[model samples]
Target: MTHIDSATAGPVSGAVRGDGLDARLVVERGSFRLDVALTAAPGDVVALLGPNGAGKTTALRALAGLTPLTGGHLRLDGDSLDRTPPESRPVGVVFQDYLLFPHLSALDNVAFGPRCQGASKADARAQAAQWLDRMGLADHAGARPRRLSGGQAQRVALARALATRPRLLLLDEPLAALDARTRLDVRAQLRRHLTEFEAVAVLVTHDPLDAMVLADRLVVIEHGRIVQEGAPSDIARHPRTDYIAQLVGLNLYKGRAEGHAVRLDAGPAITTTEDLTGPAFVAFPPGAVTLYRDRPTGSSARNLWRCEVAGLETHGDQIRADLTGELPLAADLTTVAAAELDLQPGATVWATVKAAQTHAYPA
Candidate 1:
């Protein structure tokens, strides 16, 4: 639960005159190799998002100097940290578990960083008190980790990390330890804290909502490589990968485009509003799809497919049907509409999506 301050180490060489993070992280582990180039300005919060075994954590560990880079370089606020040891890098890490010392009070936990940085005991305690106050936990300074609530403990951990005055902040699933209700409140608090941070912050998480809410930009990794990187809104609107489309609740398909029609790789052609050629991607939300018991007579939908209900599940207040047949996709409808259509496993259904509902972009 104790962390050594980077300030205790001598100055490193190769200090440049940059302002923020510039890293080309490359780490190889047997068959797995991660190569991702990342850059961010001061005050920017970037999220590393990926599924399990996708190298999100590996990238984070490399930045924190916990994992040695097999290639590439890491620079933060102008200093090259590629050769810096974990304790000598000007970085702060807020781990998933918070990792507060059980026997120490909240004040001592936050003071640990400054104390290691060569501050006097009184000065470190005073600095820790100020950080605890900024985190709105001044009253809990005397309490042990066991006495603090989940949200409070998270704040203490964040305060501990920030007390080091690090140029680069690394957070690994900071909200994953909390319950749903606690996560909502703590996420907002963390967002505010990140906004007030003057340096660069990098967060690693699998939750799309967390990445969207906390990060200014998103870097999505898959198979140890960056498949996509952009603003959350852009990524959500034009997901380039199936994993991203599913993460954003859209059904995606790749196809060859000709004007408004796209010939999908799955053997069906879908109508879209865009008029582009060559390879492209088509994406539509589940709610944009309408289901019919039988082929609707004289329907105006440009894209229609003969599908069978593969499965059904409750999604919020609606029924989400997983369909497979001529075109595999997902459809969300009201529970009443699902009952009216007699939706169930193996039920035959016709799915229709208007051209205007689908978004198409170059692959």
Candidate 2:
């Protein structure tokens, strides 16, 4: 669907690598547990993105061997790691809070990993210095963890993780520590480093923008399970659940299809461009929906669902109307349009959207 030239669309430089990480981790803590299956190809950076308490951290912890699995398996670079311990696995982790030792200098902190792996103190510090140089922290290598800025500490944490030459890199809320202004700068730097890493890297984040910009694919977890997993842009445009829909601020409905439209058995008859004639989904941004108190006469829009307003709320400068009738849908209207219609909860309304504005795909 893009106009990009074919020559510009060639594959990333390198031979095709095998699936970098193939894992099915089942972890339990108290009454809460996580059962997740995830796979990432070599050179791929997948993001575990979800809301708070959605098991994003739990899943990442499982992968890094920080949390023991009740069952399921883990494989990395085609090798089985069924019994690998956290200290033994070729995995590197950057914890949410950095977890850098406050008493250690940035160089010593990075040196710890290689040192624990049996490198001599001199050898470890030499490798650590090289990593700090690679991370552009050569001058700050002697600085203690508490003295470094947040972004600087994060870079040191990353350098420490990479010191061991890990096959699977795990990052938990990597940018959640920085200020908003620093986040932008660190994000760009992180993206460049991720692109250069030849092995698989996984990061968990709650920020949608971070997931979209830093990952090749996003694995969305809800209720301890993966609710959606796909390229970031795809998930953004077609989310499946109310949480994801609201997270992305789009209207989504599932129903039966016939020709260019899908009739929601529970809601509305929505039209779309998909050619399939069976079960499908029709989705659009709330902003694409138009609401009117009275149905327009001879309107060119082919789909119209009459409904009663259930609730109304302000979304930034726009108003979002929650409707209940033939179909439940969220429609956005300008303040002026809402005032003109005198829209309120329990008010009767007609929602219309053209087929061209609607997107339909397989559910």
Question: In angstroms, how far off is 41's CA in candidate 1?
Answer: 1.3
The best candidate in terms of lDDT:
1
Q: Give the TM-score of candidate 1.
A: 0.94
lDDT of 2 by residue, 129-237 (tens): 9999988999999999889999999999999999998999999889998999999999999999899987889888878888899999877777677777778888888
State the local distance difference test value for candidate 1. Answer: 0.89
Each model's total of backbone clashes: 0, 2
Residue 324 of candidate 1: its Cα lDDT? 97
Where in model 1 is the C-alpha error above 4 Å?
1-17
Q: Each model's C-alpha lDDT? A: 0.89, 0.82
| Candidate 2 residue-wise lDDT at 164 | 94
